[model samples]
Target chain A: MSVSELSLDRDPSSRFVPWIVAALSLMCAIALGTAFALASMTADWGRAASDQVTLRVATGDTDIPALVDQVARLEAVSRIEHLPREQVARMLQPWLGDVAQVDTALLPLPALIDVRLKPGADTSELRALIADRSEITLDSADAWLAPLQDLAGLARLVAWVLAAVAVGAIMLVTVFATRSALVNQRQTVDLLRLIGAADGYIAKRFQRHGLRLALFGGIAGTVPGLIVIFFATAAARLQGAALLNGLTPSLAGWLAIAALPLIVALVATFTARVTVLKLLRASW
Target chain B: MQQQGTDGTGEPLVAMRNVGLRYGTGPEVLRDLDLELAEGSFHFLTGRSGAGKSSLLSLLHLSRRPSRGLMRVFGHDMQDMPAREVPVLRRRIGVVFQDFRLLDHLSAQENVALPLKVANSMDSDRIDEIVQELIEWVGLSQQAQARPPTLSGGEKQRVAIARAVISSPRLLLADEPTGNVDQEMGERLMRLFVKLNSLGTTIVIATHDLSLPGRYGYPLLHLEDGRLSNESGGAA
Candidate 1:
């Protein structure tokens, strides 16, 4: 009989391969999703920081309107806003608590000015303009956000590495499973060979079996990951956390997750074919 | 018209010169064998239980390579043949094992249809039709759908025999093919083999039933302690 009809699907080792593959797929999907989300968030934060700078002017002896007009007049500066004293205190409420509000005269506060720079604007002119004003210090968003951005970039790299490891794990597990299946189905393989079955015909049956299991497992694993991502994204959105907005995967990210099953199936099929052909040859 | 047994090269279907076989550092089971089977030739291989009849059949089936000899089948040197070409060569040879190696998962019909399936020479409908007819001929119509595990010894033997002949292979080797069946069934199975032989299939039956060789009037190649002898008791 054709090796396809040899009841290989009922083999004991075969029963566990799909579940193992599914577990690996789930881990892979989640890792990839995390990487994608981190990338999205990093891009958003980098864009916001790259085009903005903040100026903190000491309260005493500073002409805020004249400074704003001077900064706005710079050719590279797109817009500038001088924050009122009360708003600066409000921004520090999380750190200073109600003390800043208890009495404005109790502490010396700086006047905050937010500045937006045009794309490709050089910061040297702005820095030079503020250099002579000892009380006015220019703080570029990029300078303050560099450490946080580095941490996010490292996290994204780790997630990508984890996803790649998951794929490698799937391949290794498939190899073991295929080898176990061959051991279990030794009698059937010998029978097929005795009956004049070509090695390709026998290997094809195993390849098809491996592909089927991998596809089923991949889809099963991806579905749960998608569910988790959906709910996690929803929760992040509900909480209105600006930094957490990047937790949602983009369209391309979703498409990659969707393609995971096919990728894993191809891997499994090729592995099974090579393993079976090599083992069959060894038997001869 | 029946096709010639040889592949138009006038070579015997099989030629073994000084062939010997052993299992993993053990004493040789078959020793210094030199034999040839001409195109469309029929012979009975008679030997005791340990006379290496199965070993010889396995060698012919390409299941094992001769340890030190020049063995050729269908005009190809088996020792030098590529691994991939083994299956193509095997398709032209059919063997019925002594133990009736029918796959327990497949039904009798599927077992009988195996050769055709592996050869892929016939479509499913034709395979089914032919398998059914062969099952009926072997008196297994009632057990066509029965798995090998559930079938009786004689029934399983019949299924094996049917499988061996289904592909109409150029060389047919049977190791005690009728050992499980009664005299009536054995005679019936012999008729089937004779019919196939008449149609240009080379046949070899290894059996302890010494009466068969004389009754069938075929040449007898007797084995005695890993050696072959051409007996004069049968037709030459």
Candidate 2:
């Protein structure tokens, strides 16, 4: 056996320490991965919403060109494209199936116009310009997607909270394991101390043990965690749902998840070192 | 037969002036221990079974801080020694407990090699050779791989002795150093201790068997009722 291992007697609880760290690492990886994904998705959605607006013009006796001309004059309105009636009809195909077979004259579809805006464009001026035109409704995509943005923000917060909780739990597990080892190897510790072993020297042995086990557990837990995330993202993609399009983790998110095991190992090692040092100092 | 002095050297290796120790609120286990073990001196601490020989040694070993009075080991005042400095102080003083206190999980050779490993003394390659030499000297070459549970009492004592002297500590405190060994083995261990002392290591052996010290003719520090009852004989 190595001299570090020889410093303390083997504790039965030591067998469970790595497994506990692994489980915690799994939780941490998933939580952090989710938070990172949500943050990335929200950022993209926010950018898109801020740069675009939509308008619905009524088809009943409304001067569409005059209304378009007025909106186009606004400083914020960079570009405006009036969506064709055929395209609008296609957009409603899922809700009103095969509207193409109906008479075009009988269809009461409103003219849809997509408006692109400059960055940081003021929307209140656009709202005031269309205030009197009841037939022309203005819709800022940012305002429309605000609730979803809030929900995503809340979810990101929850995931971050979960990751923090998992890290705290790993630290607590390390503390408990170190303490148990200390108790089990009390005689050996006494012998070492009596024979002039430095407290740091003794604590280092326990720290190295904890670090090795935590690293193993971290890898064990992280592999499965990443696998779960991978499969979940793939399944979402297979479903081809618009809502699930941005659920996959971003590059940074994947990196964070990949680093989870090492983080756990470091945290466990630090906690064990501090615990041993504190107890040893308290004893004297 | 009463005496109190160093070996005529400046700043003795270990010094205690009216030292006292107690557990919790109980009565003192050691009291009024005015003594010194100077450089390269060899001494025997003798007392009755409950006369605090082990307790006195514990003070020198830096295991317990004195409840009252001054105690110094390796020039650091025990009463004011910082917590961080205790281990550094202890590293210079080797101790052998009365109970052997060998880690059962470690092999005999590992137990014997503890001090060097603990002190991080010498290079790794030199460590193996030195440890092997010490183990063979203790006549445990065949039992080097054996764990403490498998070793006999005398064998464990030898391992403990080897561990105590591995680092060549400036001061060695042994409690019942030869309690479990035969006379022949005991004599052999004594010679090892004597050899260590001749190399400038101060030695203190606490034993109820007075004949060991009588034979060696080392200075004797006798204890009675938690006090140093007498000190006599030897060059010190």
Candidate 3:
């Protein structure tokens, strides 16, 4: 066996290295996936929310043609469309089943109008003008949109927090594993020192070994995580929830994910090197 | 106060003035020791158990710093040298351990080649050539491919000796080089040290063998109760 492999073969911690790396990768994938999903969902919600308003008018005695004509001529109104009554009834069908049998007049749900706005237009003026009628109400969706946007932003922050924790965990794994290897190979390291092997030589050997273990572990851990994300995305698609569009990484994103193992490996290598140099100095 | 005695001008290989050593919080083991060995000299360090022979050798090997002293090895002042320069200093010396700390994972030839690898002196093929010749010289050519776990005590002892001298270090220190071997093998290993000494390499072998200085006709440095006594060469 090569000199580098000798230390690893004798070390007890070698067996668990891959597992530690894999666990970290799995956790990272989930976090990144959730973060990606949240961002995409927010963007979609924001796009659908902008430049629009939903209106519910009681239409008790007002002429339908007159209301439509007045709304179409409003200064800020770009386009107006009537929300079909059947579609609105279908939405409430789960709670009020079979709208055909339900009393249409007694329920008296106000007629809904879909309003498109000119860019940068103020809706408050129009709302004030319509509110005087006592039969009209304006719903701009900004109320729920602001809260959902905040929720998405919160998810992104959580994802970032998770990523930071993963990095810390990776560093911890390498430090502990390197320490264990050092302890088990005490005789070997001492012999190297006596032979006048420089600290770098000895440290390099262990660093390379730890880096390899972490790389393999990272891959073992990461691949499954990515696979889980892919399956989850597919499941979401099958369930007709496009909100998972965020979870599906783009080409550049996949490349970054592919590099996770290498990042962990590098962390392992650096940690091992520093640990050896310090320990060697301490011994002398 | 550290001072450089300097190198490359026929300076002594080692010079210690009032060198004192003790492990952490322990009583002094070697106290007020003053000694020097001229370049290219051979000596045996003979002392009783717990007489600080190993500790003194440890100081010489650069494995331990004298707790208090002005010490220089290869003319480089111990305290004046930077920590980064320690390994560079150590490369000039060879040490054989009493435990025969050969890596069990490596074969006999690989163990011997280890010093050359560390020194980065020659290419792999050249190292292989030099290590092969030494393995043969040590009379272990037949077991050159054998790992430490499979080798007998004598075989391991020879391998350790070969590894120590592989780099042709200016000074060779053996902490009980023959501690684990039989009489014949012990004598044989001593002969190897003698052979290296004759080639102008400074040699110091730490052993309890009081008869060794007399038989080898080399100078003796005797340590008793942490005190060192220098004796003249030739069976004194």
Best by TM-score: 2
- Give the candidate order by descending TM-score: 2, 1, 3
Candidate 1's displacement at residue A213, Å, is 2.9
Instruction: Report the TM-score of chain B alone for all candidates.
Output: 0.90, 0.90, 0.92
Rank by DockQ (best first): 2, 3, 1
Candidate 1, superposed: residue stretches over 4 Å from native? A1-4, A57-77, A94-111, A119-136, A236-241, B1-8, B136-139, B229-236
C-alpha lDDT of candidate 2 relative to the true structure: 0.83
When 2 and 3 are scored with DockQ, the better candidate is 2
Q: Report how closely model 3 matches the true complex, as a DockQ value.
A: 0.52
| TM-scores, one per candidate | 0.87, 0.90, 0.84
Instruction: Tell me the deviation in Å of residue B48 in model 2.
Output: 2.0
- RMSD in angstroms, all models? 3.9, 3.1, 4.3
Query: lDDT of each prediction vs. the true structure?
Result: 0.84, 0.83, 0.80
Largest DockQ belongs to which candidate?
2
